[model samples]
Target: MNRLFVMMAVLLAGMSAYAQSEKRIYTKAERKSAEERKFQKRMETVMDSINYADAVKALEELDFVLEADRLVFKRGETAFVTSNTNFISLSDDNAVVQIAPFNGGGPNGVGGITVEGRASNIKMKTDKKGNITFSMSVMGAGISATVDLSLPKGTNRASVTVNPNLNSNRITLGGYLLPKERSSVFKGTSF
Candidate 1:
């Protein structure tokens, strides 16, 4: 009886080991999809708390446009000054936006200029009619701009304008951002 019980325990341990090994590891595609889903879910929850009307109201309190220029040395006697002007808008959801770089000004042009930055923990929500609203904490720059946006109904596409004050840094007029649909923005280009 002792011998039989020992053999039974060994067999059970082997079966458990096999079961553990059979557990599936997620493929790269599956992992990416899961991550995307989590991000979307988080965005939805954040958006739910947005108030589009108040966002619009706040825009009235802002200066509406800000311009800044900086001087930089190139190589030889030629120096260039880069000037940027931001037109901003606010949504009830809490989004800070900058005008998208256009044909001559985007990163694709020769002697291209790119300004890369990030804002942390901005909030947003869409109205029942599909108007989005949001706020943002401008990072790196000492100033933050608030906006109100009137987005198109039935779609996520909207025109944004921002007005920032650089009174703090006396240089960078900063604000939040609301991203447009990546697919639409990246159309005809490899993203």
Candidate 2:
């Protein structure tokens, strides 16, 4: 009986030791990769703070690009598009609105129409909570439209609704607002 008890104790101790040894141990490369990811995340947080401030400044100056990666129509159809081909840009007294419903080749060489016009009736308002309402009428040779933009507080994301004077199809562009210098959007031919 004493021998059986001793054998059981020895077995339990050996099992416990084996279990501890099976713990996952990261290699040197994995440890370095984890530390690098942590550092990258911290850097992105700091950069986002600075970028947010710059976006606010650009909004005040009326010089920013709102790249519309998502397109929504009044008939309830929504599409996710590439930012390079679909964007609404405002610079001083001029506003350019482009919509490429499809990818690859078409009109404006980006599969859609690009309209640039002189912006008038520019009404920019900001409430106490930092929300913004910017509306303007864009009139050109053949384009007559009203562009209304809304930016919520504490974030650079924005939604712009474009209403054409002659059409019932309302289009809204949803995306982030970025400073002009930081904007990587490519502008196609405009009418």
Candidates' C-alpha lDDT: 0.38, 0.86
lDDT of 2 by residue, 23-110 (tens): 6899999999999999999898777667667777887787999988899999979999998778988899888898998775766888
User: Number of clashing residue pairs in every model?
Assistant: 30, 0
TM-score of 1: 0.29
RMSD of 2: 6.6
Candidate 1 least-lDDT 10 residues: 182-191
Candidate 2 lands at a TM-score of: 0.73
lDDT for 49 in candidate 1 is 35
How many backbone clashes can be found in candidate 2? 0
| Candidate whose lDDT is highest | 2
> Model 1: runs farther than 4 Å from truth?
1-113, 141-150, 167-191
Candidate 2 wrong stretches, greater than 4 Å: 1-49
